[model samples]
Structure formats: structure tokens, C-alpha cells
Target: MKQYCQSILIFFLGLNLAFAQNKTENVFIITTDGFRWQEMFGGVDTTILKDDKFVRNRDRIKNAFVGKTAEESRKKLMPFMWDTVAKEGQLYGNRWAGNKVNVMNPYWFSYPGYNEILSGYADDSINSNDKMYNKNITVLEFLNKQPKLKGKVAAYSTWDVFPYIINDKRSGIPVNSGKDLVQGNLTEKEQMLNEILKNYPSLASDRHDFITYYLAKEYIQKNKPKVFFLSFDETDEFAHEAKYDEYLFAANTADKFIGDLWSYCQSTTEYKGKTTFLILTDHGRGDKIKSQWTSHGQKVSDCYQIWMAAIGPDTPALGEVKTEGQLFQNQIAKTAAKLLGYEFDNGKPVGREINSVKN
Candidate 1:
């Protein structure tokens, strides 16, 4: 009788552990390439768009500026962002703070900027005005190795070089982006779209990570991946063109996409009340407005200033606290790992686990 009682107790304990493990929430990371802190928060009081360059899209710039400080403008331009996350969790201009080095310094162009953020260490040995080719271990690689996280991590980018940024082949995680093409079973719509891509071969579809967005949303709803990394490359492309109106449109579109993702997460029981979102830029641009059209390769360039915002259930609800906590782009790897209860081994691992959702 004593042996039978002990066996029953052990069985119940095992079931309890499994239940706890299966009740995991998710973390979503989104990046807007070459996003600028100045444009995001610089008051309309001094906005160039408020003056000579003002157009239909730039008009939104003026409306975006409500109060005196950068924080105020940010709140105005992104009401949902401010009310939902920044006000309660953490939001700041990484550039105004002393995070210049890790904030895509050298103002070096996109590939290097992305590599540093992903690899978590700046490499002086590399400096090419070309796309990256070598595969480097990323935060995704580390997170995917955690117990039960395998086949649960995925990445989507708009750039052609994303295959190299993550080296998805080695990681075995599904990566979709420009020209990479989505593989596996497809819906009827997808099958039609694939046929279209082959026939026209010239028509521009929403080839950006918008497809990645759909895939991520579908996977979360179906398979429920624990970690999701999404990179929107359209804004960066428009920025390079120096078409202010186009750039603004791209930013606004990306904002809407983010809003949609948040809404979707809130509707799901597994992640509705538990998920956290981290939004950031890959690097800054130039100082002069003209040069800003196509720049970001100088260390002292004013454009190197970047911005970051986080929202979710675990972050403190302080509306817009002016705390001076330092945050580096490299810290993202550590912070994400901490939030998901995993260990990250990045070169700069001093990232604090900022509250994502209120505990």
C-alpha cells in the first residue's frame, strides 16, 4: 500500500510539470531597417517637413508633434505605441542616450549594422560595401536550441542577404524574405501567387516580409512558435530612395502592420495576455537632410542616433518614464533570452531583462 501511494504521487507530479511547461507564452521581435529617432520624435516645432518640404505625407509629421519634448512627439505620432507599451513598459531614444557604438556606429550601411545586431559584437575585421555572405550564429540559433523550442523559432526579413544574416540552413529554422521564396505546403491563394511569380517575373507583389508576417501569424495560431523575429525591409528601401513621402508611407504602413500583429496576439489565449513585443531600427542615417536621403556611414554622423520601444504584459506601466537605463542594440539577444527563460551567449551580454508584461 505504501509503494502504490508513492507511485501515484510521482505520476501526479510529472503531469503537473508537463502542464507548466506547455503553458508557455511567446516573444515577437520586429525591426525597421535604418529607422531614425529624430524623425520619430523630433518635434514638428523644428521639423523641416513643417516648413519647405511639407507635403501630404509630411503633413502627418506636423500632426505627429504635439508637445515640446521628443517623448511628446513620439506619443502623438504613435498613440497606440505610447498608450499600449511605451507609457507602461519602456521606450527611449537610444541615440540621445550613450548607445551610439552599439546603435549601428560608423553609421556603416545596412549589412554590417544588421550583422552587429544579430551577432551581438561589432567586427572591425569586416567593412564591405557589399552584402554579407558568411553565416553567423544569431540569437535565433541559441533560442532554438533550448529544450522544446526546436521547430518553434522562425525569422523573416525583406532583404536578400537574410540567408547570410541568420544562416538559416545551419539553424534549421524557416526564414522567408525577398527572393528567398516560401516553401512547404501552400494554400490555393499561395499556389496561384506562385504561378503568378513565375509567369510575370516582373510584377511587384508584397514580396517584403509581409509574407513573413502572414506566415508568422499563421504559425503562431497553428503551431504556436515561442520566438518570432520579423524584419520589415520596405521602409529601408524607401529611405534609400530619399523620397520623403514614400519613406513616410512605408513607416506608417509598418506601424499598421505592428498594430495588426499586436491585435492578433491579444486574440489568442496562449499569447493574448502574456506576449511581449520589442520594436527597433537597424541603424541611423545622415545629418543633413539631403545627405540623409542616402547615408549612415560616419561615426560622428548625427544620423547614427536610433530609437527603440517595447510593449507587453511584463513591462512596467509608466506611460513614458525618463529613466537613463542604457540599452545597446546588441543587448537585444540577451534580453530576449531572459524573457523566454533561456540563456544567451552574445559577446555583450549585459542586457537587463526589461519588464515586457507586468508580472
Candidate 2:
């Protein structure tokens, strides 16, 4: 009887350890601004690739982005998503399969979309991409207010308006966005990055995503924040310029960047096995008319269609969800908070948590 009781005690302790290890402690919210579900799901649009108006260097685009079929093309475009995330996690908004994800906001542009995403509310007053401080509190702010997460939430974005979008002035979250970036107590790498920032050519007040990536990486290494948001903007910029070649290149490189981030997390002791990655776009571009792919706003049709993916120790490996379903961008905030074992509530009707994204 004594031996049997000892065995049961050890078994229960092992079960408790497993349960604790299964909980996700860190979350990464990554957004590729304005990347559409079409290119993400169907790969390269051959129609756009063939049009001389868009593809200036057919040889380069074909050599790099094109595949004989749409599936092959998309696999080449975002290998990390199709090959890794789809296999190990879940992907939504593949309209081809009727698994749809969209923005709850009426205005299908950057600012409104991001607001809906981080705040879980779509305030109509946030109608423009103007640098107006957000009136709503975001999941980041709510998380920072938590006793355990204070000073452990950070945001980095390629767009200048992020400070206003995240409302860093009020939230007190350290948001590093274009022009207003890291300062004081600089590491050697940070000093070089700031020097490069000074000489780099500006692109519509958007810092190059590469620079933003390095700065975020440095911060992640140093701070090990409980919550992190890294937003890349070049895909949207190149698309708006009608540069398909550059847009495809931007998407491809961003995939590599995401893969690098996940790998770093897995290798790091503080982050390994505890971090969850929730990847998606801020908004979508027009879909059917081909030319409309370059524009994303309330005026553009099908611009509300967006995609989302989640991978982590807690999320089951369901791969690309083929079952017919609907998800909204507003759900992201709650979903992110949920992963960290918190129910985000601030006297607001936040979007319901996406239970399917996790265990």
C-alpha cells in the first residue's frame, strides 16, 4: 500500500508539470501591412505577373516568384507559412476553401484595421490614416497594466503612425516606429542601426522593414518582453507603387524574417517552448479586378478580406483550416490576451476570443 501511494503521488506530480509546461507565457503579434490573401493563398497572380504595367522585369519576377501552378507559386512566395505554419499550426482566410477572416471595421484601410485588431473595437471616428492618438485602449496597454507584464510589452512598426495607433504616449508602451525609434543606452548594434537610419532614404514616412526588424530583434534579445508586436510595411508600400516585383520580393523576405524570429525564440532559454506567434495582415487589398490589388480602402472591393495564422506550444497542429468558418480581425486582441492566461476586459465589448487558435 505504501509503494502504491508513492507511485500515485509521482504520477500526479508529473501530470501537473506537463500541464504547466503546456501553458503559453509569451505571445508575438506580427503583421505584414496590407498583404492580400490572394497572393498568400494562390501565390503569384499570373495575370499581374504577365502585365507589363506591373512586372517591369518579367525575367526576375518569373525566376523568383512564379511557379507553373498557383499552389507552387504561393509555396515559393511564403514558404514559412505554407511549409511550416500550415504544417505545424493553423491558417485562416483561404477563401478558396471558404475559411474566411475579415476586419470588423467598416473602413478597410490601415488605421481602422489596426485599431480593430489591437483594440477589439472598431470606432468609426478612427476613419483615416492620420497621426491621431487612438481613443481606444489596446490589448498591449491592458497587458502592460497587468502586475506581471508592466514594462514587458513592446511594439515596433515600419510606419510612422504606430505611435498614434498604439497610443504609446498614454499607454506608456515603448513603441519604436519610423523617425521616432530607439534612443539612449545604445548597444553597438543599435548605434550602427541609428547611423543607418540617418542616411537611409525615406519612403513615405515608412522606415525600411529591415531596419525595424533589426531594432526589434535587438530589443527582443535584451528585454524578453511578455508581449511583442512587430509590424512590417514594405509589402503595402511596394504594392501601392504598382511594383509587383518589389511586392513579391518584400513578401518573400518577410517570410524569412518571421522564420528567423521563431528560430531565435526556440533557441533562447527564456523564450523557448513558451512563445506563441500570431501572424496576420492589418488589412486586405482588392481581389477580383486585378488592378484593384494595388489599392486597399473602403472604396476598394474585397479589401476587407484578410488572413491570419497562429503557431505555438498551446495551438494544436491543425494546419490550414479547410472547414467553412468566419473570423474577424477584432478577435485577435482577445485571442492574444487569452493565450497569456488573461481575459482582457476594460469596460468595453472586446471581440470574443478565438478559441480555435489554441488548446
Candidate 3:
């Protein structure tokens, strides 16, 4: 144990030295819960609302929502997401043509998926159906230990488990979610949002985690943390409710939020060109036949497939190509560590850096 402590100390010393010698760049990792490629690529049917169990709202299904194309709707729903940033950035569903998950397995749910992404290895030891507050050292914790990144990294999630996923007590970065506690002077828009939150009881204490985007956006302008992890939970929440229309709306909202964040970053001097934003999901839903919002957990080809997109200084322009090689959720930890120039206990190298990111 003493030897282990000494090794960690030495590793951190090296990490700090590296950061001191390099330019300070910001990395924002944003995740939308249970987002699927189909929704982002192929527009959803406005009419048919299905649950995970494949149960359909027949009446609504009969009406058939002939909605705008995904691309068109993406632009309309989120002008900034599709317009400004996307032009210079990339979207995963299309960035890597034909790129998708390997296969679905028993751990095709939120907890397992999150574990796989942050811990650099999936834990079969995690078999419980409970919210995870422990078990692994997250990428956030790993990065936080580096003296070079002092006060520059933070996490905000709409989900209650963020405190656990990030281990806030141990990590020390501010995490705001669930309750509304906007800390600074409210802009007119922010004031209106506060009114909306105050007027609407449902949005306040639902135990649903889905407001991290707005919170992070607000915090970014105020605190300007160099590394920010923003997790949105509405898609997953609506999926569980089996409300297809609601889920679609939730996705639209997510796109808008992302658009807002990107736009704000561009206008902010600290962020603009120096920032790199990455978006992805913890996991995806099962095949359509399984249900719109019904089931996931067992191995289903659909459940494993997820998408990722990156935009900013080190990214390439809008285009399509296959990921060079094998990639896994574990790579996220290593990739973030690399970008921040931090060291980790998991010394395994990252699978492949997203193409075009400058060293």
C-alpha cells in the first residue's frame, strides 16, 4: 500500500509538470442519456409513440407524424447545434460512416454503460439494480488529482447519481442538479427560466436528472471551468416513461441546449477556439421491435449501438469516415486524460483518438 501511494504521488508530479509546459485547453464532455442514432439521423415518426415493450399508441400511430427530416428538424430545433458548430464540428452518427457498437449484452442499461465509459473496464461485479455511488475511480476523479488541472474541472448532471458517478464529495468540484440554486445575478432569460421553474411543480422535484445542460451553461459563463462534464437525463427519463412523443421532444430540447451551449462558448472569449466539445450517450435502446421504450439489458444488437461527436480546435470539418480501429467506452477516460494531459491508474492506452485532434 505504501508503495502504491508513492507511485501515485510520482505519477501526479509528472502530470503537473506536463500541464505546466503545455497550453491550457478546455475540454467539455457532454452526454445525452439513452440517445440513439436513429433519432439523431432518421427523424422520428410524430405519430407512433411506443414503449420499450413494443406497445404502441395506436391512435397516435394511426395519425402518423410526417415530421421534418432529422437533419432539417435538427437545424430547426437546434439552429446553433446544426448550423454554427456543426459546420466546423462533427456529429458521430455520421462522422464515422458505418461506425456502431460491437453488440448488446446484459449490461445495456445506464449504470453499466456509465461504468464502462468512465472506469476503463466494465465491472461484472456490479449486478445490483441500485444507483451507483461507489465501485470505481471515475475519469473526473482521476483527472482532479492532477495539480495542473487545479480548479479547472467540474461536473454537472441532471441525474441524481451524478454525485456518485463523479463522487462529488471525494472529487470536490461543484455539482448542481435536481434542485434549482442559481448562484449569480439572473439575466432576463435566466430570470424567466427561474419563473418557469418556480411556476411548474413537475420540473422541480421529480427526482429526474435532466437539467445539467442549463446549469452547466450558466456555470460556464460564471466559473469557466477548463474541463466540464455535462450530463442530460431527459431522453432516458422519457424513454422509461414510454412516452415516445415526449422522448422526441426531450431530444429536441437536448439539441437546443447543446446548441445554446455551443453558441455561448463561441461568444465567450475563454472558450471560443480553445474549447473542444464531445457528445455521446452512456447506452442506447433496444431494437424497435423490442419496444419504443420497453426493454434493454439483455444482449440486443440495437442496445449496444451508440453515437459520438466532437467539435472544436482539434476536430476535423464536417465529413464522414470510419473510426480507424476498435473503440470502446473505456477509451473515453484515456482520451480525456490525454487531452487534459493528466495521468491515471489505468495505464492502458486509449483505443484511438478521434481523428484530426492536434497533439
Candidate 4:
């Protein structure tokens, strides 16, 4: 343990000394809860669409998203990801193409996956989905501690547990999640939103992803935060409910949300060419058996596999990378921090920065 700590300290020292600062002064992280790499790369599953157990409106989804080739179909399914990011950014973890990204944690679930993504450490103790305050210091918290970035980091999620997952109380980063309303002076839009959300429909424990997106967008517009995070849950919620059509729609809608947010960032002065968008899934779903597509955990096969996409002034335009290599979820925290020229170190050994993303 002593040697390990020494190694980590030295690693970050060298990392900081050799760091190449990029143009990204800010970063926006967006995630689709439990979204799969398969659908992300191959488009909607036609076989599953035909099953009564899966889709609600087969013909409608077909007409809207399906196409003859994977390239064509994926373009229809998530137009912004295909048309824009594909041309201007990098997409990782298309397993069929040999590039892969996997969860470093043992448990293939939300909290553990997110912990790895945010903390850059996969604690085996974080094995549950309960509303427990995280002990680890996330990159957000690390940035929040910075003199220049204090009070400029914020996160929002559809899941009520986010306040606990992020440990907002301890980190001092505001996490507006679930049924929580905008505090302090509320905009007229915030007032209206709060009223509707008080009676808003939800799937089990999660509020609507669209609501979460808009709420976060309002905050982003209001504050122009240096580090902003949003996690949408409908894709995972619909999959858990066995509503395949809703899941696909959620994925497609998430694409539109990304496009909208990026468009806004480009139009705004604070974000324009100075911001980077980092996108990924909290976890991955099953794949070996068709019926297991809705399930994830330690028991689920291929649930460790995940995907990520990036767009920014510094990232090279390498869409859907076909190179044969592997990356882990733990690398993302440093990747996000490094985009803005920070070495994310919380005293634990983090996965090294993804060098490819720096260019």
C-alpha cells in the first residue's frame, strides 16, 4: 500500500510536469444510463423490434430508425452523433471494430460504474445502488476545491440518488436531481417547471429524462458553469420496464438533447470554442442472450462493455475509431479534467490520461 501510494504520487507529478494544455477551458459531461454499445454502434435491433415482448410500435420505429446498413441505420437512430460528432469528434468502444471500453469495477451497475467514471477508482465497497453518500473525491469535487473553479461545478440527474452519489453536501457542488426544485431566486421558467415536476410522471424511482435535461440546461444558461454534468435515465428505465420502443426513443431523444446542448454551447460566448463535451453511459447492458438485453449486474455477461464519445476543440476528428485497443471507464475522470488542463488526483492511483483525446 505504501509503494502503491508512492507510485501514484510520482505518476501525477510526472503527469503534471509533462501536461500539454488544450483549448478546452470547460467540459460538459452527459450520460445515458445503462445505454448499450451494441445499439450505439449497430443501431436498433431489428429482431428485437419484431418481438411482442420488446417493441410497442414496430412499424413506427422501423420507418423512423431502421435502414439497410449499420452505418445508415445508426445515422437515422442518432443523427447528431452520426452526422456531427462522427465528423468532428471521436467515438470509442465499438467492440465489433476491435476498439473496446470496459468498466473497471467488478459490479456492473450504476453507482459502481459512475464511481469509476467520476472518482477514477473502482472501490469494491461501492457494490449497492442504495442512496449512500460516496466516500471518494470525484473530479468534480477536486475541481470544486480549486480557487478558480469553486462554485462553478454542477451536476443534475433524473435519479434522486445523485445527491448521495455525488455527495453534494460534502463536495459543495450543487446537484439538482430528482424532485428537487431550483433553490434561491427561481426564474419564471423554473417556477413553471417546478409546478409541473411536482406532478410529473416517472418510471419507478426516476423522473423524466427530458425534465432533467431542461433543468440542467436552465442552470447552464444561467451560470455558464465551467464543469457541468447531466445524466439522463429514461433509456435505462424503459429497458427495465421492458419497453423497447421507449428505450429507443429515449436514446434518440438523448441524441437530440446532446445536439441541442452543443448547439447552445457553440452559440454562447462562454462555451463556444472553449468547451468540450464528454459523453458515455453509466453502465452497459447484457448481450449474449437476446432476453438479457434489459438486465445488468455482476451476473450479466458483456455488461462490462461500454462506449464513449467526445467532441471539443482539442479532440481529433476520429469518428467511430476502428483501431484494436481497450480502454477502461476509470480513464474518463482524468480525460475530462485534462481537457481543461487539470491533473485529477484524489490521492488514489487513477487510470492514466487517454493521450489520444489530447490532440
Candidate 5:
């Protein structure tokens, strides 16, 4: 009888241990600034490809992204996203298919869009992408304050304005932004990366996306933050410059970076089987026609339409969601919190948690 009781206790203890392991969920929120849903889902618009004003080297652009069909083209552009994430996770905001994901902010600009994404609401006052500090608390701030997550939340962004947008001073979260030297002890590779950052030419407004990606990846490998935000901005910059070829290249490269990050997470014990990745854009740019593809703001129609993709243990492998429904960008904050087994309440009226991503 004593041996039987001992066996039952051991079984219950195993169950408890499993539960604790499950609770240690890691969340990665990544964004590509102003990346339109058009190229994301449909791939390089043929109209833009033929337009001499946008395409200086037509053959080069076509060979890189253009295929027989939209599906084939997009797959070529984002092989990891289309081949792996699409099969293992869910993707929303295919407007042609009736699924729509939009930003709540009417401004449809970078600062406002990112604010709504992180704070779960639209603030009309944050219309400009200036260096002004954000007043509202972000989901990152909320998570950093949590007992288990304190000092374990980090943000790395390519845009220089992120330090202001995230209000790093107020949140007390570590934010590494444009041209900033990496601090603290570093590995040999990290040291080399730091030297490159110092010598690399300034091609974009902020830092190059590749630099931002590598910095974030190195930090994650070393610190293993509970929650991390990696934001890339070259897509938006290239679009604004009307450099279609560079824009597509940046988008394709971002896909590869995300794929590499996902693979790394799966290979590590701390992140394997417990990490969730939420990939999205800050806002969408203009349509292919109407000569507005380079701009995004309140005046740009359809600029609010964005795309979001998720992959994790909690999310169902529904692939591309074609169901008739509308999703708002504000839900991202609550969704991130939910995936980590917590509720994000900013004490203000905000978006609800995304039910589809929860277990």
C-alpha cells in the first residue's frame, strides 16, 4: 500500500513539473516598419515592375521576385515564411481572401501605428514620427514590471526613434537603437559586429536592418530575455525612396532573418517548445497604382491594411486564414501577453486578447 501511494505521489509530482515547464513561455514580437500586405501576400506587383519610374533594372527585379503566379512569387520572396510558417502557423490580412488586419490608428504613419501596436489603442495625438517621448505605457513596459520578467525584457530597433517611441527612459528596458555601440561583455563575433557597426556606411536613415538583426540575435543568445522586440526599418526607408529593388531585397532578407531566429529558438533548450513568435508590420504603404506606393499616412488610402503572422506551441496551425473577419493591430499587445500566460491591462480601454492564438 505504501509503495502504491509513493508511485501516485511521483506521478503527481511529474505532472506539476510539466505544468511549471509549460508556464515558462517566451515571446518574440518582431515588426517590419511600413511593409505593405501587397508584397507580403501577392509578391511584386507587375504594374510597379513595368513602371520605369520605380524599376531601374527590370530584369534584375523580375528574376528575384516575379514568378508565374502570385503564390509562386511570394514563396520565392519569403521562402521561410511561406514554406515553414505558413504550414506551422497562421497568417492574417489577405484582403483579396476576405481576411483583414488593420491598424486602429487613423494617422497610418509609423509612430502612431507602432504606438497602437504596443499600447493596444489609437492615440490620435501621436501622428508625427519625431523624437518626442511617448507618454503612454507600452506592453513592453507592463511586462518588464512583472516580477518574473523584470530586467529580462529587451528591444532592438533599426529606427532611431524607437528609444523615444518605447520611452525606454520611463520603462527602464534595455533598448539598443541606431548607431549605438553594443555595451557589456561581448563574444568574439559580437566584438566583430560592434566594429562593423562603427565602420559600416549609413545607407539608411537609421541603421541597416542586417546590423539590427545580428545585434538582436546575439543578445538573445546571451541573455535569453523572457520577451524581446526586434524591429526592422529598411523596408519603409527604401519604399519612401521609391527604390523598389532595394525594398524587395530588404523584405526578402527580413524573412531569412526571421527564419534563422525561429531555427535558433528551436535549437536551444530554454526556447525550444516554449517560444512564440509574433511577426507583423507597423503599417502598410500605398497601393501599387495611383502613384502612392511610396507613401503612407492618413491621406494614403488602404495604408492601414497590414499583415500579421504567428507561430508557437499555443497557436493552431491554421496557415493562411481566409475567413471573413477583421482584426485590429491593437490586439497585438494583449495577444503577446496572453501567449505568455498573463493578462495585459493598461488601465485604459484597449483591445481584447486574440482568442485564436490562445491554447
Candidate 6:
């Protein structure tokens, strides 16, 4: 009789575990550092393309990005985002359409912008891109602490400071950033990737965005993390170098990477109907007309302006929210947490989850 009762209990426990796994939702947050909303919605800025100071080969730039209309040009640059994401999800921060999204950080730069994004609040003390460890808890850390997601959360970033920003040592989350060698038992393909990364010529001080994307994809395929974050830095680096052509190219390539990620999630059984993607940027650059397009700081006008897009099982296919109200970057953390069926309470006041994505 005891043996029979033990068998029954085991059966019930199995059922409960299965139910929990089925209810688990995945969230992937992707950020392109310093990418502007203007080019995101309107496509390559022709004004900057024509300026000899920014564009070295005006005709080549025109042929590559310029079209008869802004819509055509944008589509040409980011066909997947303009075609699939716009049709299947929601996009915000088109200032001309009166939909605005801005960062809450007083300092319009990488660390502060990223902190506001992950922590659900801006820290005035974190004003620089220093290597100091983040004091406040991030949404990623909160998710990592959950029973279902512990040891199943990972971050891959092009910038090296991500370890400090996410406090990887304290959170105990695997962070593959900068030129750090890929660790763990990697698949053959992933091993090849690591070998290539080691041999590839140095394009930027940080690892290339392609390496970051592939490494994150490999990790996702191997470990199937419940939550993931990928940050690409080429856009910001190229812009700061005043290489407009390379910036546009990098932006287009990043769009392709995003499309590929969405496709992979939809094709995989674990994430097919359960994954949500929140795509955004840390901050926006200055105006092209002001010749400060390559810069973003407190002194730069419109530097706070940023953009966000979401697509998933929970988000409605609203496509380009043009409402009058403004959205802040801090809201992203709560919105991401809400999508994964968790409340991101960091024991402090923060922005609420975005209403549009709270279905």
C-alpha cells in the first residue's frame, strides 16, 4: 500500500512540473547602443548623406540607402523590421507622429541609459561609463533569482562594461562580453565561432556585433535560457567615429540579426509560442543639422529620445503607436517582467508596465 501511494504522489508531482514548464514564458531583450529613432522609422537621413563632412562617397551612400521616398529607403535598410515587426508587432518613438519615448537618466550616455532600461529607474549618481558595479538591482537579476529562471538567464554584449552594469559576479548569471573567450561545453559550430573570433582582425576595441549575436544564439540553443539580453555596440562606435556609412550599414545588419532571432524563436518548440522580444536602444544622438549627430550627452539636444518595439504572444500587433503620450525608458524593465509572468519589484518606486503590451 505504501509503494502504491508513493507511485501516486510521483505521478501528481510530474503533472505539476509539466504544468510549470508549459506556463514558463521567455523574454529576450535586445538593445542597439545609441541608435536613433529617426533612422529607425524614417530610414537613412538624406541630409546627412549629402553632407561631405559626414559622408565620404555621397553617390555610394545615395545608391545604398536613399530611395525615391523615406518609406522605401527605410524598408531597403531594415526590411525585416519595417516589413515583419511593423506588421506583426508594435513600434513607438516616432516624434513626428507625436509618439515619444525618452530615457529618464539625466546623463544621456551608455551606462546611465542602460541602467534606466534594466533597473526600472534612473540613478543620478551613475553619470559616467565607469567600471563601477551597479548598486541597484536590475530586472535581469530579479528574474535570475526566480525559482524557474535561476541559472537559466544569460547576457551577451559587445561592450565590456556589461559585466559591471549587470553585476554578473553578484547575480551569478553567465555574461559573455567583450573579447572574453567563450566558456563551457560548446557545440561544434560554436567552437568554430570561437576559433574564428580569435583569428578575426580587430575591427573595434570591443568584440564585433556578429560575434556577440552568434555567441548568444549558440548559448540559447545549448542552454535554452528562460531570459536573455543581447547588446550590440557597432552603431554607437561607428557613429562616434563619424563614419556615417558604416553606421547605416551596421544598423541594417543589426535589423537582420533581430529578424533572424525572431525566426529562430518561432521555429523552436520551447520558444515557438512562448517567447517575447523587446527591442530598443539606449539613447539617441544629436540632430544632423546641428552637426552634432555623432554625439550624445547632457548638452546634446534630443539626446534623451529613444525608441522601443515589442513582438510576442502577449503584445498586440498595433504597429507604430502614434498616441500623444510619452513613454520613458525605465518602463521597459517592468514591461519585460510582466510579459514573463513575474512582478519586477526592486523595493523602490519605478515606472509602470506599458499599457499597450499588457494583454
TM-score of 5: 0.93
Q: Best-fitting candidate, measured by lDDT?
A: 2
Give lDDT tens digits, candidate 2, residues 155-181: 999888989989999999999998765
- Candidates 3 and 6 compared: the better one by TM-score is 6
lDDT of 6: 0.88
Which regions of candidate 1 deviate over 4 angstroms?
1-24, 43-47, 50-76, 94-107, 129-135, 192-206, 288-290, 346-359
lDDT tens string, model 1, 97-191?
43332453354666666766666655554465355654556778888877778888887766667777777877787877665554677666565
Worst 10 residues of 6 by lDDT: 15-24
Candidates in order, TM-scores: namely 0.78, 0.93, 0.76, 0.94, 0.93, 0.92
Model 3 worst lDDT run, 10 consecutive residues: 46-55
Model 4 weakest 10-residue run by lDDT: 14-23
Segments in model 4 whose C-alpha atoms lie over 4 Å from true places? 1-21
Per-model CA lDDT versus the true structure? 0.63, 0.90, 0.63, 0.89, 0.88, 0.88
By TM-score, the better pick of 2 and 6 is: 2
lDDT of 6 by residue, 1-359 (tens): 99999999999998666445433399999999999999988998877887787777777777887889888998888888889888988899999889999999888999999988999999899989999999889999999999988988999999999999999989898888888878777788888878877898447548789988998988898889989999999999989988898899889889999999999999999999898899999999998554899999988999999999988877789987887879999999998887776779998687899978755
Tell me the deviation in Å of residue 276 in model 2.
0.4
Ranking by TM-score: 4, 2, 5, 6, 1, 3
User: Candidate 6 regions off by >4 Å?
Assistant: 1-24
For candidate 4, what is the lDDT? 0.89
Off by over 4 Å in 3: 1-24, 45-81, 84-86, 94-97, 102-106, 180-199, 203-211, 290-293, 299-301, 322-326, 347-359
Candidate 1, poorest ten consecutive residues by summed lDDT: 197-206
Q: Where does candidate 4 clash, by residue pair? A: none
